[model samples]
Target: MGRQVLTWIGAQAAASGRRYVRLATARDDRPLRAYYERAGYRHVGDPPHAKWPTSLYERAIESG
Candidate 1:
């Protein structure tokens, strides 16, 4: 189900001429972080924010 949702999102983003699919996750969630890493998203950076700690990730959209 997660992969399906990612596929759908990639499709939509590609249709709109986007270059990448970016997301943020809680920095301390190791399991969730691993899941995204296994899904091919690379750890980009953690930008400063006033709210909860976040880790950014991005996956390039494959040209069709």
Candidate 2:
């Protein structure tokens, strides 16, 4: 079941012509953010803010 779901997700991403898919979560969401990095995402930087900071991540897609 997991394999089937992953396969479908890959197909959709490929068909969408997306460059890369990144993962991020709020500071309060440390667990979720950790998951993203573990899934091959890199920490790029933080978002513009005054009171608090926002997390940002990036992943590059294959290019033809």
Per-residue lDDT over 1-64 for candidate 1, one digit per residue giving the tens place of the 0 to 100 score: 9989988999999999999999999998999999999999999988787289999999999997
Task: Tell me the TM-score of each prediction against the true structure.
Answer: 0.93, 0.57
lDDT score, candidate 1: 0.94
Count clashes in each candidate, considering only residues at least 3 apart in sequence or on different chains: 0, 0
Distance from true location, Cα of 62 in model 1, Å: 0.1
lDDT of 2 by residue, 1-64 (tens): 6446534554566679976765445756787677667655688877667256568776565555
lDDT of each: 0.94, 0.64
16, model 2: CA deviation in Å? 1.7
Alpha-carbon runs more than 4 Å astray in model 2: 1-10, 50-52, 62-64
